[model samples]
Target chain A: MQHYRRTEIIVGAFMLTGILAIGLLALQLGKVGGLGEKGYEITATFGDAGGVRNGGDVMLAGVVIGRIKRVTLVKSLKAKLTLEINNGIQLTTDAIASIRTKGIIGERYVRVSQGADEQFLQPGDEFDDTESAINIEDLISKYIFSSGSN
Target chain B: MNGVLNLFGFMGRGLLRTTERIGDGTMLCSRAIGHLFTPPWLGRQLVIQLYAIGFGSLIIIAITGAFTGMVLALQGYYTLAKFGSESLLGSAVALSIIRELGPVLGALMMTGRAGSSITAEIGIMRVTEQLDALEMMAVNPVRQVILPRIIATLIALPLLIAIFDVVGLGAGYLVGVNLLGVNAGAYIGETIAKVTMHDLLTGWVKSAVFGLLIGCICTFLGYRAVPTTEGVAQATTRAVVTASVSILIADYIITSFFL
Candidate 1:
């Protein structure tokens, strides 16, 4: 009976440790997009969103204030990104939402630059001034061609 | 014509035998799971088995996870450095461990450590007529014996895999940041940013399936072992091999759908 009790205690400890490990992974290591949070949705259209993925970061002044909610290719053959920005931050109408890469050859994120306009954009608003991701391949080809012609 | 006929017959028999074993294994799993609902809960037996299987295997899993993470960092650093992107090492190590190695290696290690023991124990029971003794005593041998082992394995494996992943990531951070000169902020940030609920779910699902596979394959081989010491040894070997291979095959199938 004592041996059985000891076994049960050890097993219980093992189970608790496992649960703690799982909790750490899910809470600390895993990323959850802005869902069921105090957030507003805003759309930004870009010519080429490139590597911008859903759940990608939305940075304002180098701080992540939100997440990229979704990425869809609209009928215009352009990428349409829906960003979920936190409640406190406000974006002016002329604010630019641009697809920017981290370092070189890193994951892409949306960077929203503040504008001079005093008027704040409401939820479901679309950014008129959006910049597409810079295609490295295209830049390389252009550089090679221009330099060769010279 | 006779030689060709013999070859065809041998192939057909082998195929049929394989199919028959699969069918028997499925039936055994269903019965064991069914017993889970119909109680006499066997809680004591389950705790005992959980200790034997899960707690016993923890050391091996941790060692494997730590080394795997360290090696991943070492290899990833050198490879990614060639492209001048050593910053991506954190993401590389975390992604590989979380998505692929964590569950698979955890399951494979469990199969070797616990699964072989499970087969041997049951095989010994058969050899000593203990299963028959249980039958004569009006206790269903399958219910009394197999059910708890399967249930314990199913409950244990996912938790072990979770532990494995955490230990591995910690080892990876230690290597990438402390040993090598990768930026700690970028390493951790990329890992946190790139890994989503989807990747975590993928690992959990794979681990659970592997748990089920290990439980069923080990128990089935033991239950069907010939009543001899040599037979028990062979069953133990076969159980480990089969469970390991099945985990890999199932991993590929599950990953295909998730991808």
Candidate 2:
């Protein structure tokens, strides 16, 4: 009986470890645990949004630094995308955004390339140097039809 | 030509015996399920079995969970590095463990540990005439002996697999972040972004079905074993083998439906 009681206590400890790990994992794995990091939103205008979808990643130098919040089409055949960046990420006013696909056939995300400038972009500022996704199909057809016409 | 004919004959009888055993096992399980609701709840026995199965199996499950996570982290890091996208390792490890490995491996371990013992224990009782004696004394052995174990397994395995998932994910974190120097935020953030409630529920559902498979097959085989020493031994082996095969087949079928 005493042994079983002790076993139960140890089992209880195991359960506690599991519960605490779950709490930590969930926090780390959910809500994008910013803890002290407050995010700020910025907008970018692109000729084409390509495959960059909402909730897609905003990456800088191969590291995910933020998420694409919303994508809307502009009347001038441009795409306007809203990005929410992590706290402490500073972007220059001349920085450029490009919608890069993962591979030949993969989802697209916005990659931010930094530029040398004394001026830094503030929250809600719009980036002017953005490239839309170059439609692969458009590129292929242009190559195929023009070459076949030869 | 004669040898080939003999081989076919042997296989034909083996298949026949296998189907016959399947029929008998089905009847055993249905009868036990029928007795499940008819009072004489065997509450104390259920508690005892739960302690024996759940508590007794914790250390192994924890160790397995940790190592599985660590191995996944190491393998995933190298694979993702090839693509220069090591940040996605967290999602890979989490999805694999939560959707498949945690439940399936945890149930397999439980079957090898607790289910095998349940078979041997009950098989020995049958060999020693204990079950027959209970019947002579007007005690329902299925209600008293089998139901408690089935109920205990049904309750215990989900808890065990949930622990396995949590601990495994933590181990992956330790290896990926502290050991390999992946950014903690990126590792965890990617996992959280990609994983959903559907993944979590799929693991739990698989564990529950595996628990039922282990409990029913093991207990039924043990209770129905012949009253002989060899019979008890064969029953134990058959219980483990049958329960494992059934768990895997059921896993594929259930995952197909989910997909």
For all predicted structures, in order, the TM-scores are: 0.92, 0.75
Q: Report the Cα lDDT for residue B180, model 1.
A: 96
lDDT of 2 by residue, B1-259 (tens): 9999999999999999989988988887777778877886665677678778887787888899999999999999998888778878888899999889998999999999899999999999898888889999999888778888888788778778878888898899999999999989879887876676567768778989999889999999999888788998999999999899999999999899776
Best by TM-score: 1
Backbone clash pairs for candidate 1 read none
RMSD of each: 2.5, 5.8
Deviation in angstroms for B151 in model 2? 1.3
Clashes of each: 0, 0
The residue-by-residue lDDT of candidate 2 on A1-150, one tens digit each, is 887676667656655665564555455544435541357999999887885766688999988888887898889787899998888899999999999987666568899999999888999999969877879999999999999999
Instruction: Assess chain B of each prediction and give its TM-score.
Output: 0.98, 0.95
At residue B255, candidate 2 shows an lDDT of 93
Interface RMSD of 1: 2.1
For candidate 2, the per-residue lDDT at B44 reads 63
lDDT, candidate 1, at B151: 87
lDDT (Cα, 0-100) at A76 in candidate 1: 68
